[model samples]
Each structure stands twice: as C-alpha cells, then as structure tokens.
Target chain A: MKHSTNRLFSLGAIVAAALMAGCVPPSAIKPVDNLSQIDNGKVIVVGKIELTPELEPDEQVLGSSYEEYRNLALVITDTELRQPADQLGIGALTRRINAPLGDNFFVSHEAQPFFILRSWLVMNAEIKVVSPNYVHVPGNAPLLGMFGIDVQPDDRAIYIGTIRYHRDTFFGTEKVEVIDNYQQAKNEFASKFGEQVQLRKSLAMPVMNN
Target chain B: MKGWVKKTHCFNGLTLLAVALLAGCAFSGGGRSIDDPTSSLVFGYMDMEEAPTSMDYVKLQQVAPRSEAGYWDMGTDDGIMYNQYVPPGSFKVAHFGGSSFLMGEHRYSFPTYGRNATAVTIEVPGIYFIGAYAYQEVDTGFFEADKFSIEPTENPSEKELLNTLLTMDWVEGTQWESRIKNRLAELQ
Candidate 1:
C-alpha cells in the first residue's frame, strides 16, 4: 500500500509539472551591454507596454481576478502579417516583456522590415492552485490591427513608441492605442546604450482600419 | 485500505487528464458522403510539393453569417482533396499541417492580409470550389526557422476534378457529379 501510494504521488507531480511547463515564460532579450552588440546588420527596437489597473497580489486567487496580466509577449513577424502570426513559426519572433509595465528592447536583423503582429499575455495567478490562462488583444478579428515598422538599411536604433492596453471589467481588452513617446524612449535608450548610439524615431502606425 | 482508495482515485484523475490531452489530436470529420448535394459543401485541392500523409489535415474557419461561426476540420486524401459540408458563408483557410515521424507537427497559415489571402464566399452553395493552391516550403537556412508559402494556381482544372469525382463510388448514383459539373460551368 505504501509503495502504491508513493507511485501515485510521483505520477501526479509529473503531470502537474508537464501542465505548468507549457506556461513557462519565454526568455526575455538581454539588455545590450556594449555598442558593438547592436552593429553588424543588427538593429535595436525599443518599446513600452502599459497595463492600466495592473494586477495586484491580493487579486491572486483561484477565480478570475481584477486583472490577470502576468507576462506580456510581443510577436514580431517578417512581412507576413497576411495570416495570423504564429509565434513558433520560422518567420516569426517573440520578445517577452515582463508583466504590468516597463520599457523593453529587442535586436533584429536590419535589412528586413518587421511588423508587430499582435500582443498576447499569460495570466498565472500568484497562487499555484490554478493553471495559467491566455488573453490575446484584438481577439483574432479584422486582422488589420498589425503595426508596421520600416527600418532603413543604416539605422542602428529604432523606437516603436508605447503600446497601452485598456482592460474592461471582465479583463478583456477594451482598447489598444499606439502612442508616440519617442522623447522619453530616446532618453531611456540613450541612458542604456549611452549617448553615442543614435536612437531613430520610427513610430509604428496601424496599417489599415479594416 | 485508505491508502489504497486514495491511490485508485489518484490514478483515475491522471488517466482522465491524459485522455483529454490526447483527444485534441483525434481525426476531424472529412470525406463523409453527403446524402443531398443541394446542401452546402466546400471543396478544394491542395497541391503540396511533398504530399501530406494520413496524419495531416486542413482547417477552415467560418467568418461571416455570424450565426454559424465555427471551425471545420477536413482530413485529406493523398494530401490533395478536402471536402466538408460547411454552411453557406464566408470561410477562410485558417491553417494546414500535420505531424510526421521525422518532422513532428507543422502548420502553415494562409495569409490573412493583402491580395494573397485565402478566402471564399459561398452565397448560394450547392457546391463551391475554393480554388487550387500550390504549397511550398521556403528554405531559410539549416538552423533558421521554417517558412512556407501558399499561392493560388490553376492546375488539375475543375473539369479534371469533376471527371475524377465521376469515377468515385460515392458520386456514381448521387447528384454530386451533376452538381460539380454545374459548379464548373458557373465558374466559366
């Protein structure tokens, strides 16, 4: 009886770990340590994500909380926004931004233009009783919500402005706005990469309204 | 005795979870014979460079006629033919791919933007041909990500497909032959 009980407990733990593994956050891009890292046909893209009425520790429970934002990931694709972006696809790249709010940057190959296909968030309540949930802004319709950023061949640093997500009472995305805050973003990039690295303002604008 | 009962309960719970996960890969309904051809049906041909095996399938998502918004999964025959009894509405090729021993699972989504997007509207569908497409994988690099392109092409014409259907046992006595012929004529 004791042996059987031990086996059952071991099996349960493995299953739980496998389930949790799917929600494990993708690795965040490391901040640039030197100027040469952004060289060699590579460009640094900077942006910020803001979640209004952020998730609070008290709201972490089994049921739905005030806001379930845990990890926000921006999916970048190489001129293939016609179909929905598959983060795992070869042409697609994902940069995970730490939850709630902060400035983030990612390095990309310079020659090819990139588009911010969409943003998806993983909602894992701090308490471990429940599994994680996912929420995608723009909810898979219209397909015109993609933002395009064109990088010039010689451009070293590009700032795509700030993306603000407004959540409703049910935590569904009520609205998404791309606001130009290039001055502050420029300052942040300067402080990190130093004043020598030129920060170019290339705010991402909505491609179409359809 | 209490430990034994707890072990059994735990085993049952794990079994249920495993079953639920595996159920997602179950074959979606495809190639089922339709009694009445007059009912709505959507059919298409996919000419893949490397044909998909029995493990592969395609999916269509109904976008318009909001009342019937849902997905239809259609398994292929020789990775070429796919037919489903979809309602009369606007549908889009959401994605298509399958698992293989060597390649594992791969899915390619049709473009949802620009002119190359894959979509068709069946306003008054007896039967609708969504067009023939050529699917090819783009070689990015050895260690680079996999990329693919799906484009519309005119090959294995509608008449040829109609002739092929006429030979099938399912279409012999039914109205499918005439319906497909009519659809071809409508396209002309």
Candidate 2:
C-alpha cells in the first residue's frame, strides 16, 4: 500500500506539473544546472520583469546613463521561485536569465510607460512559451547591474547570479564589469526599446479602454 | 506461531529497506543554463532603472490592488502565486524526458555565489532548507559556499512549497541537475 501510494503521488506530480507547465512530456524535461530549475532555454525563457515608478521617477540603477532611463539586472542567483508576491511554498518561478536572448527582457518604460504595467514570466532560450503572471509586484533588480559598475557602455550581455527564494526575496552577486555590460545593454535597450515604445503604448490602448 | 514469526521478520526487513530507500532519494539539483545542455539551471532576468538601495519583500494580506506592489504571502505547493494555492507562475522549464529523479530535478532551486570569475562548490550532499533575508553589506550575500551547511531555516512557508519546491542545494557546478534527473526516474 505504501509503495502504491508513493506511485500515485509521483503520477500526480507529473500530471500537475504538466498542466501548470504546458504538456512537456515528463521525459522531455531536461536537466539544466538545477533539477527543479527548468532550463528556460529549452522549456521556456527565464526572465521576470516589473515596472515601478522610482521615487525620483528619474532614478535608475542598472542603466548605463540616466539618459537611457533603463537598467539591466543580472540576477546572479542561487534560489527558487517562492510565493505570489513571492512567499514560500509557491512553485519555484523566477526572472533569472542564464543565456539571454536579444529580446530577452526589453522594457520601454519611457516609450510605453502605460504598457509598463507589472508582469513576470519564464521562457526557453527562444523567448517562446512566455507564461506571464500578473501580480502587484513590488521590486527586484534584473540581475542587478548597478550603474557606475565597471560594466561596459555598449550593448552586451552581463552575467550575474542569484539565490532567489519563492518568498519574494533573493540574494545575488555582481561585478562592476558585468554591470557595465548590462549598462551597455541598457544604452542600446533604451534606443531599441524606444523604437517600440510607441507601439507598446498602442498595445496598452485596450487596458486603457477598460 | 512459526509462520507469524516469519511474517514479522519480513516486515522488519521491509521497514529497513523502506528507510534506506526514502533516505537514498533525500538529496537533489540546482540552477539552469541555455546554450549548455549540460547545465541544470532555470531562472529569469529583469531590467531595472535604478538599483535598489535596500531591497526587501513582504507578503500581502490580500490579493493587492494594482495601486500597490509587494507580494501576497498565501502558502501552498503549486499554481500561479496569485491563484489560490497556486505556485509562483505557471511555466515549465522543460523536463529532460528522463525519469523520476529527473522529475526531482524539476523540484528544487540552486544558487551560485562568488565575486565575478570565482567558482563556488558544495562537496557533500544532504537535505538543506533555505530562508532568505537581507544581509548586512557584503551588500548581497549568496549564503557563502561554506554556509550551505544543513540547518533548519525557520522560514515561514506553506507545507507544500517548502516541502516540495524550495528544497535547497549546494553543489559543484550544476551537477545537481543530472543527480536529480537520475533520482526522479528511479521512482517511476
């Protein structure tokens, strides 16, 4: 009976996992660095983003220049997705990007501040399977590439790590150089994200309609 | 009477086996990678305008209004963190068509810590619980490698996420990925 019960539980887990994360056959679920850490590159892309009005509205951390008005976080991580608003016991979800895409997390706050409503998701390297969950997000650094860090001034991918907890809080490590790379990304992100800013604003029309 | 003794002996043996088996699968995986299929990690990234001076998160007592930001702390094992008892978000990092242990791989989180260009390693394997808190500058601390010691992290959590998802990890590279993959398959 105990053995059977265990089997039943395992089956349930597989089924439930399938439902939550679209039907990726249990076998297709590859092993990345973390077992539970689903490889977003394959199954999904792992990047979570939020839009918040800095107290100064003009203040930004990860951006290369305040003129760029954007910041890129590196999220050097070692944790799991906790709860909504990020509490514990929640299925592990994160905005951690190990191998980022050109469009991994481009946000046009200045161009489409309206479309800047808060949202989060996990995707594979392809940027496909974006599972966006809406929540009253508070704050998190995108792999924190703090400004003035030695990070580059041109477009580049900054490598960062973190130990995220399902419980909203996360811990990470970053370097001045990487922050610079992210800053570079920001420099270009602002320009690139700016082009789409108008369209992003246009997309938010429906929300405004409501 | 003799037959009863045989059954009792068998029962004891089974119990011992059960303990060993249960304990055998106690340890598991961490992190994620994209280009490297060999890695075992899955995480997201965000872009911020300004770095947070002091970043902290709290649980909302209710399903907060858009006017506010902060996480709601309802405790459960799975589903959208916003959905009643659902997990964080409804997304799946592909399960490597492996086995039960692989499934286990999908059930944990591993974080790496160090200054840029440094490697952190966890030499042993065991069950460790994680509790997150802001540390005094060192600014952001990744529970230093040596800090991965097995301890009771008195973090508040619902029975499921704590028991099922947030099982901790401290290992070399992302080896936990394959370790958990093989482990999860054994059960099936």
Candidate 3:
C-alpha cells in the first residue's frame, strides 16, 4: 500500500511540474532604436509588419486561483481555445486587425493640434505586408489572493518588434526602418493633443434621410 | 492482498493514459478550409462617428446558416476591436458580398436593436475589415448601413492596428469556425 501511494504522488508531481512549465510567459516588450528624422506630415508606407499571436492555446488564463494543485487542474483549461496559430495560418495576424479606432481616441482638442488623422495612416490604406512573423503573447503568472480578488483580467497591452517603411525625402524616396514600441507613440499623441470639438459636433448631428 | 494491489496499479496507469488522450483530442482540427485549403480568419473595425454613451456592448451572430454568436465590450473609433475565425460558406459568394453576420448592440435604457448588412462576403485566409455602427432613427429604432465598406489595402498602418488589438482579449482556434462551416455545408 505504501509503495503504491508513493508512485501516485510522484505522478501527480510530474503533472504539476509540466503545467507550471507551460505557464511561463513570453519575453518582455522591446522598444526600437535609432529612428531617422521623419518629415512632418509625411506618410510612411508599410513595407513589412511583424504579426505576433496575441494568445497561446493552452496558456489562455481567464481567471486566477488559489487551490491545491489538484483542484487548480480543473479550472486551468476553461479559457483555452481548441486551436492555436498552427491551424490559423496568416489569419491569426489578420483577425486581430479588425477593430475600429474610436472617434475621440486619437482626435486632438487643442486649437493648434500637434497630431492629425490622415486617411491612409489611420485607415491602414497603403503598403504591402510580407509574410507575417510570429511571437507569443505575455502570460499572466498565477497570483494567490484571498477570495476571487486574485483573478484579474489581463491588463491590455500591444507587442511589436519592428516595421519596415518607405518615405519620400527632399532628395528622393528612401526605405526606413521604424521600431514599433507597441503603439506608445500614438498613446502619447492622444494624451498630448486631446480631442477635437468640431469633430464631436459633426458626429452628434442627426443624419438627414434622402 | 498482493493481487488486489497489482490490479489497482494497472487501473491508475490506464487512468493517466486516458486523461492524456482526452487532452490531445480536445485540440484536434475538425473542418476544411475554402481557399488553398487554409482556415479562414475574419476581422475588422466598425467606424462610428459617435456612439451613444449608453451603448455598452456589440453583439455579432452568424446569419447565413443562422448560427453562432459573440459580444464584446464597447469601443471607440480610436480603438475598435473585432476578431473572429471565418467559417467556410459563412460568406462564400464572390462579388463584394456584405456582412457575413449581423451586428447589433446592447444599451442600458433599451433592449437590443440594430440592423444587418447583406453585402459583405467572407474572404477565406484573408482579413476582411469593415467599418460599421448602429444608430436610432426616430420610430425606426436602430439600423446599420446596408453597404459594408471594405478596406481595399492589404495592410493597414501597423501602429494603428496594434493600437486597436491591445484592447481585446486573446483569441485562438478553429473548432468554432469548423462547426459553423460544417453546419452551413450540410444545409447546402
């Protein structure tokens, strides 16, 4: 009896170890370096984009838990999808790009706004993306808190490595490399310039039926 | 006593094997892709000039075969997020078919009401981005534009795309898409 119990415990330990190993999150987000002088009001053509998978199959963490390892096993699989990137192909990269930019998210409020919303840049109008490259999303390390307080939603974040661009300079057209700091630049622009009043008024007016 | 112990040991080993098999089966692929035999992914944003603050959620449903559904917390034009796997035949017709499914909304003061678009078509293994939103028209309740505008370019601005995706929960898989496709195929 004692020998059998020992074997059972050993098996449980191996399984727990494997689950823990899978929980390790991906690498930290890195910022790009040595940006060239971009001319004002210049539209940069998107040459290549790095489309990384925002979530892993087995690693999807919906909520947190503080139970014995045995109990935690049942809850761990709830949020995971049946398939990951292997089956989705380039679609995984494309699926995530569908969201609309809210009216106020990028609009500048100031009289002399530092930023502007150009059709091509805001709408993803120009440029050809090469075959997408892949990367894993950052994972949530298990947290042990009282009650259900520990089970917090993942703080929203965007991760990107680099972008290849083409820009027209005084001399001629030149290809440039831009580091995508996960949209940090856009966020900064939003915070600094604020929302526009005229755009808001236009949005609020009722549409006239033809 | 020794024989009983041996029997219990065999049971435990078999139990472990069964669990492993179940896990493997949970991740299996189910259906075929329409283009180049690759699975489909459908995603895009709804461009709203302005939305009522009362509106809190956007609901999406499969309309063709008439199955499947999803909803997301409300978002703005600065960051609109929509991502889903496109089941085969959900939007199969070729010439600029509109709105694979119906898009509606949930508001605080009112029941869910909105319109559907018939012009959108599903482009398998490709990203289909649509700009849409719902509005109330006096006694008419709510409606979405009939014409589904397609973003013509292969790639939108990279920084802009990242900005939108940051707000969404992680999504993966084809089982849902496969099931939808299978049902539609059966109906046809």
Candidate 4:
C-alpha cells in the first residue's frame, strides 16, 4: 500500500511539472524592453508573415542536435545525444511559443484597428528566420529572427517588411526586407484577410465557441 | 391565530406602501420627457455589421439649441448580433439636431451632424428612434486604406427598436414598457 502511495505521489509531481512547462507567458517569445517604440495612438495591422525559403526545412532548423534530445529531460547520460534535450525540434518549439503571441497581439480586445490575416492563411505566409543573440542553444549557431514593424502614421499601414537579427559574430547587426513590396503585400492581405475588418466596421458579439 | 393574521395583514400593507413610494420617487426625476421640460425622450438602435475588436457605437450630438454628444454602447439581442435602447434624453435638443464622432482626427476637415445640418428632432412626451450606421470601405484611395463613414439609418423599424429595448436595462422609465409588451403580443 505504501509503495503504491509513493508511486501515485511521483506521478502527480510529474504531471504538475509537465503542465507548468507549457504555461510559458506570451512575453517570453518577444522582447518587451523597448515596447515604447510602438506608438499607442497608431494602429498596427499585421500584414502577411512570411518565413524565408532557406529556413523552411525542419532538419536545417532543428539541426542534428534534435535527433538525440527527444524531450525536455533534465538528465542526459547517453553519448549519442547530438543536441541538448530542451533544444530538440526548434521549429516546433518556435511555432508553439510565438504563434499564439502573434495571434493575441493582433486579434485580442486591446488591439483595436489591428487585424491579422486569417489563421489558416497566416500559416501559409512565409516567416523569415534569423540568427539571434537572445536564444542560446549548446554548440549550435544562433538561428532566430525578430520582426521590427514600422507603422506609417499618414497611411496607417506597415512601412515595409524588415526582419532584423543579430549577426553571427559577437558585434554588429543585419536587416533584410521581405521580397514583396509594401503595396503588393497589403493588396495580398486585403484580398485574403477580408478588407472590411476595421474598427469602424459593423459591431457584433462573437459567437461563443462552446 | 387572529393575532398572527392581523400581523401578516399589517406587514403586507407596509410592503405595498413602500413599493408605491419607491416607484414614484424612481421616476419622479427627469426620467420622463414630460417631467423635464428642458429635454425630450430620444432612443435609438445602433449597429455595426462587422464587429470591431473592442468598441462599436455611433457618436450622436446635439450641437444646435443645446450642445450634447456622447457614444452609446449597443447591446446584443441575437446571436453574434447587437441592438440597444439608448437611455432617454440622450438626444436632448430644443429643436432638431445631429451628432457625429471624429471619423479621422488627422484629417483637416471633420464632419458633424448638427450646426447648419438638420438635426434629429426630439418631441416632448414622445419617443423618437434614430438609427445610426457606420461602416468601413476598403481601398477608397490608397492601397489597403479603409474609409470609415457614419450615416443615419433609412426606414427605422419600430419593431426592431422594440427588440433592442428587450435587451436594454430597465432604467425606471425608458418609456417603452407597454410598447414592448404590445409588440411581443403581436409577434406571438
């Protein structure tokens, strides 16, 4: 009876730990240090989020390190472990962390006059990945990019698609514009995401999902 | 038994008297248009077809004769739909007047519903329903530029107004209790 009780306690602890791991806050994926850079008065309508073609493959993203580490295990005794256990499946790790953050930023109640492309459509939009100084993976090179949006006050639109990331070296930075221009990107967004979605558009309560 | 019966009768009488006094005091204020000579009772149903993330309301104003303008939050009466009974005297104007909110503050010229414009007239002791409409037009000029405009609703339906009143709060005297019951009876 005592053995079974001890086993039950162990199981409960494991379950609690697993649940807590998934509860990463929205702020974790993005930097909030310079949030003042974003103007409060101006609205930010998220255009198409496109990832580059080079970072498209899972092997390239996850690296050989992913094969050894299957889960977030604290201890790794085996020599075959190619990457840190927590670093396994970086692509999945990124999506799980950032997708909801992006969704909440554009579609949540506080974000008015801000609209995002439909979820399914956004999934198709290519996202550019960059090497970052922020995320640390053992032995592997930095491979994370961040979006720095500039809103045009006169136009009330995103200025141009620029992805900024830290250079691989210890110093300096690099910025790249998305292949599509601003007009083309906005047009594509309007076509796909329903152009009528706006703050002054018709008001109606959302249907309860339950 | 007789003493108990007498006590219950006395309690019932007091309860009735209290209810009557409370009702009288509640509506004694400027709730009714007749009670307040300075203002008239005005109510309306405002809606947006595509709901915004946070807010949705028409900015109504009474610029001429008396200056008063405010945003009325509309409530939903149906599934994913919104309608409401605006509190009385919201459109308080001596004559007729109009109201509008800033469509774009950045613009050089802002529009108004009153002041040289024909305002929505409010009649004393009578209920007037004004329907407000606001919509966004895509690509009016610039690429992905949305145009926002507000206009009065055409063919304001009394039935629809009653439906909206059903979802509104019972604020002592919205002046639509009997009208609402009658409409519901007709529907039945």
Candidate 5:
C-alpha cells in the first residue's frame, strides 16, 4: 500500500509541472516579417486570395466591362500569419475595379465604390502556385508581386506585378478588356490548392467539424 | 456505561487522526491544496466583447488584467473603456503563475480566447462541462486550446474583472462549469 501511494504522488507532481508550461504568452504577427520570408531568391509559394463583386446589368459605366468581378482584393501575408511582418504585408495589399458609384461595396470591410462584380459563379474559389513574373506587364512584376511592395534578396527582381487592373474578384463588365485581364489574373492567382481550400480566414463558425 | 463511552471517544479520536493525515499528505517540495471550500483557490478567463449597449458594459471591464498591458496585477479596463487607444494585443494571455499559498480572485485574458476585444467572463470554482471546446481535468490537462495558464489570485480586482467577460453558458452543469473547477484546482 505504501509503495502504490508513493507512486501516485510522484505522478501527480509531474502532471502539475506540465500544466504550468503554457502560461507564457504568444507574440503578435507583422507584415515585414512575412515579406522577408518571400525574399528567398527562389520562387516563394504564396497563396493569392482574390475577392470579386457580383454586379447586375447596366450600360454606359465608363470603365465598366461586361458583367464580371471587380474591386479585386489581394492578400499577400505569410502562409500562417505568425509574424509581425505578416501584418505589414497585408497592409500593402490592393484591389482593382470599375464601379457605377451608387451601391457601396467592401474589401476586407473597407468601403469600395469602384466596381460591383455581380454575383454569378459560386463565390467559392480554387488556388494555385505560380511563377513570380506570371504576367509580362511592362510596369509591375506581375499584379500579385506588387502586394509585397519591395522585398529583399532580389532588389531588381520586381516582387509586385505593375500590370494595370488585373484583379481576380473584380466588379464590372465582361468586355474585351475584361476577358483579357481576367484570363491573365486567373492564371496569375490559380493554384492546385483546389476550389475548397481557401488561404484566407473564413471567420464564420461552423456548427460541427468533419 | 462509562467503559462504553470511553471506547466510543477513543474510536472517534483515531478516525480524526487518520482523516487529518490522509488529507494533509505533504511531500518535501509539494503541497496538497486545502479541501476546505471557504478558502479554496479559484481561477478563470475574461473578456468584454463590445456591444452597442445603452449602458456601458466597459464599466465592469476596468478591474481585470489585460494582455495588451500585462495582467491582473493591475485593475480592470472598465476605467479606460479600451475604445480610444487600446493596445494592439490587449486581450490575449500575457502572464500566468501559481502558488502554494492561498490565491485571491483575479481578472485575466486568454489562453482560451484570443482578444479582449469581445469580452466574456468565466468564474473559477465548481466543475464546468465546457461542452465540445477543449478542456482538461484538474489533474489531467488534455485540452486543445493554446497559450494557456493559471493566474494566482493575489490581484485586487480579480472577481469584478472576470464578471465582464461574456459566455454562452450562463446556467449550471455546462462544460464551462466542469472545466472551471478542474482548472481552479490545477492552479491551487
């Protein structure tokens, strides 16, 4: 009886220490840290999140193309958002679109007035890994690369794509300009991650987990 | 009758002695928490989620320790309202420690919840169910939540600070109750 009692007491001590370990706090995430990771000379695998607005039919909106996505939002933070730099990386992200001015839209909750890509295709998306310079645009490295602004290891190797208005989840029309830009943007953001795998946080809570 | 009375008294004495020794088992470097509920240790997490309330809920927030500005060693955020210039990470768990001595009521943020932005309260003491969310028994911390810790009650506004944090389980017997007791015991 004495032996068993002593053993139980010893075990309890060990368990107590283990529970105390997690008391240390976690650190904040930042943007520059995220961009630094991608500075690696080789191609860095980044998941691009594109948001397109669903719009209705309206003629004569100057820059508007046929019905399609507009005011595209691009997210270029680190894969896990575990660093302070990652937070900064998100700050440099942008969107491109042409809207009609009446109905206001939102990008990451920021109000947008430019484009309203009408809801059509399922809001669901498919992601892919692509080359840093996917689009041979004259200005930006490619539309997605611009999200990083200026990263290191390759100063001259433009990280951000300066190609005009190549947003994925853009709002507006599907005209000649729209089709051409959409195709370029699609190839730019597509990844083998598939339609169900979203790189961004889905903030909504599910009733159950699979 | 005298002999019988003496025998009964002797049995009672022996029983009391055994009970004291069993309950007071002390190891050289360890301490068993006092089972006396009157002075028992209790611990819990807190948060004050902002709601467009007619009456200020933040009035109740000022007494607890916040992750953005250290812990319960200070009073709650009810005084500041945390609206104007709350630090970036004010709601996460910052520091946690335990003691053999009695711990007082304390207000603290998360090892469970991330931000104090949306606050909620959790009382320590009694067993809580805590449902499907990750949790552990006092002796067995087999839960999934991260940055976890237990705060000693030395802080002054511990009880009032925790009252501000919100929770779905306001009633008894939920997972919240079971886990809270287990967590408090661990801290003690």
Candidate 6:
C-alpha cells in the first residue's frame, strides 16, 4: 500500500510539473545590433510604449497577495488581431515584443501588414492556485485598441509612433492612444542606428471600423 | 491481503486511464454526425485554394457571446462541410483555418466589433447553414508573413448541398433528411 501511494504521488507531481512547464511565456525578440543588417525584406519597427501609473518595485513587497503589473508586451500579428495559440502544428503568425515601460524597438521580419492587436500586461499575485493573470489594454473595448502599420519590402525602418496606455487602477478600465512623435522618433533612431538610416513615418492609428 | 492490495492498484490505474481518455475526447475537436434531428447543428462550407488532405483538416471556432468560451469543429470535404452539434446560443465564427504542406497553417479571425462582424444566433434545436466562403491568399514578400482573405461564395448551391446531405450514409434513414430539407427551405 505504501509503495502504490508513493507511485501515485510521484505521477501527480510529474503531471503538475508538466502543466507548469507549458505556461512558459513566449520568447521576447532580442534587440538587433544594426538596423542595416535587418535586410532581406525585414523591417525595423521603432516606437515608444508607456504605461501610466508606473508600478513600483516595492509594491509587490508590501502585500503578499496583491495583483501588481509585472511586465508589459505588445502582441503583434501578421494580418489578424488575435492571441496566438500555444500549440503544436501550424499556428497563427504572431510575435511578442516585451517592450519596457518606455521607449523600445523591435524587428518585424514579415513584409505583410502588421497590426498591434493589443498590449498585454502580466499581473502577478500571491494566489493559492497557479494561473496567469493577463490584463489587456483597452480591456473591454477591442476596437479602440487595434492599431495597424503597413511594412513594405523595400522599407528599412518604420516609426510606429508612441503608444500611451493608461489605466485608472490595477484592474480598472484602461485606455490606449497612439501619438505621432516622428521628430523625436527620428532622432532616437539616428542615435541607435546612425543618421544614414532613414526612419519612415508610418504612424500606427486605430483601424477604422468601416 | 496481497491480492486485495493488487486489485486496488489495478482499479486506481483503470480509473486514471478512463479519466484521461474522457478528457482527450472532450477537447479533440471531433464533430458528431447527423445522428439526432433534435440536436443543434451548425453547417458551413469553405472553398480553399487547395483541397485539404484529410476530412478534419479545416477547423472553425464557434464562440458563445456571453462567456466567450468556444470549441473547434473539424470540416469535411463534401463541399467543405462542417457538421457539428453546437449548443443553442448566440455564437459566431471567431476564426477558421487549416494547414497545408506548401502554405503552412493560417487562421482568419472574424471581426467582432466592425461592420463585418459575424453574428449568428441559434435560437432552436435545428440545423443552421452559415454562408459559404472562399479563401484567397494575399501576396506577400519572400519569407514574409502569409495573409489570406475570405469572400462570400455561392459555388455549391443550396440544391446541391441538399442532394449531398441526402447521399450521406448518416442522413439516409435518420430524420435529418426532413430536418435538412426544412432548414434549406427556410434559408431560401
């Protein structure tokens, strides 16, 4: 009886570990060394991502069981606006940009039109059950959250403007706005990739409902 | 006492196996045939650029409006038919796609908040035929992301679909024949 119980407990532990392993987040794209090296039809998407009411490091230490925003990332897809399923076989063409709470850049290799489906933030709390708490920007208003920017094959660099995401509270109503700051974006691109690289302004705007 | 312990172990193992199998069947996306006329059935047709290799190649997602929970329904080759027993609710085609050796896997999400959002309401336990659609591949740069566009098509007419349903073995003797005919008449 003791041996059988031990075997069953071992099996349960293995299954739990397997399930936890599947919850690993999607890999973040590493910043490229040279924008010119991002050739072969690849385009560099430069933009600033800001989250208002920034989270403080000491906030999580204050309470043992409070949901606090941990990380913010942009969910970009090729043509559609949907979360990519984490499964085997042919899946949706989706990429995640783990942008910091400030100015950031990511590379888009797909020449097709890319859209910022939504910005998702991970909220970590000391809950009894192990689960993921994902809070999307423009939470209940998906239409206002979608922004589209076309990437051309010959384009070397594209500035998608600054994305400002503000939330009233941790799990409150959120709003997203795309601001055009091409001049500042151009200067930033020059500082990172040199002045020779031309940063085309194709600001991402909310997709029209028509 | 040893035999009793062995029997307990066997029973526990069998229970675990049964649970695992049930879980697998619940999420496998396998649809039911025309077995019950009282069952709420959702039928649709898709015209792909290339024929799928298997009957279950293409799949569609039906989502409930309130809870937003959903399931996948596998499609058949007969006019790209998708015959599934869906619960009676206000559901929509969230997305549909399949994989091919050359084109890889693709999914097209139906717009939810625009003029083109799919709105389907299954109010009763009857067969419903969502409109037919044809998949068109959009041109993209080399090694770039693939794109597809869907358009409403009317290749396999209602008459043709009714004839095909009548020929299916599962529909031959079942009340599904009258149910399908009645539903198609209402559609027309």
Whose DockQ is greatest here? 2
- Give stretches of model 1 more than 4 Å off: A1-210, B1-33, B36-38, B51-57, B61-75, B94-117, B141-145
Q: Tell me how many residue pairs clash in candidate 6.
A: 0
lDDT of 4 by residue, B90-169 (tens): 23211111111322111101122112111344434444544444332233435322333434455346566556555555
Which segments of candidate 4 are over 4 A away from where they belong? A1-210, B1-41, B51-58, B68-110, B113-119, B132-134, B143-146, B150-156, B171-175, B179-188
**How does model 3 score by TM-score?**
0.22
- Residue-level lDDT tens digits of model 5 in A67-154: 2323332222222212221111213332222222222111121111112111111111212233321211011111212222223332
Model 3 chain B worst lDDT run, 10 consecutive residues: B1-10
Q: TM-scores of all models?
A: 0.44, 0.21, 0.22, 0.25, 0.18, 0.41
Residue-wise lDDT of candidate 3 within B51-78, one digit each (tens)? 2222222223332333222121122233
Chain B TM, every candidate: 0.64, 0.17, 0.35, 0.42, 0.19, 0.61
TM-score of chain A of each: 0.64, 0.21, 0.16, 0.31, 0.17, 0.65
Total clashes for model 5: 89
> Which stretches of candidate 6 lie above 4 Å from their native place?
A1-141, A145-210, B1-38, B50-56, B65-69, B90-119, B141-143
- In angstroms, the error of model 6 at B85 is 1.6
What lDDT does candidate 5 reach at residue A52?
27
RMSD of 5: 25.0
Interface RMSD of each: 17.8, 17.9, 24.9, 32.0, 26.4, 17.5
- Quote fnat for model 1: 0.00
Model 4, A185-209: lDDT tens per residue? 4554455444643322121111211
Better lDDT candidate (2, 3): 3
* Model 6 score (lDDT): 0.49
- Which candidate, 4 or 5, has the higher TM-score? 4
List residue ranges in candidate 5 displaced over 4 A. Answer: A1-185, A189-210, B1-72, B75-96, B101-109, B116-188
Over B4-103, each residue of candidate 5 has an lDDT whose tens digit, in order, gives 0001122244444443443312211012222322211122322212111111111112113321212222112222121111211212222221111122
DockQ of each: 0.02, 0.03, 0.02, 0.00, 0.01, 0.02
Best by lDDT: 1
The lowest-lDDT stretch of 10 consecutive residues in candidate 5 chain B is: B1-10
Residue-wise C-alpha lDDT for candidate 2, range A105-207, written one tens digit per residue: 4311111011111122221011112112111111232232221111222312222211121211122222211111334443443454343212111111112
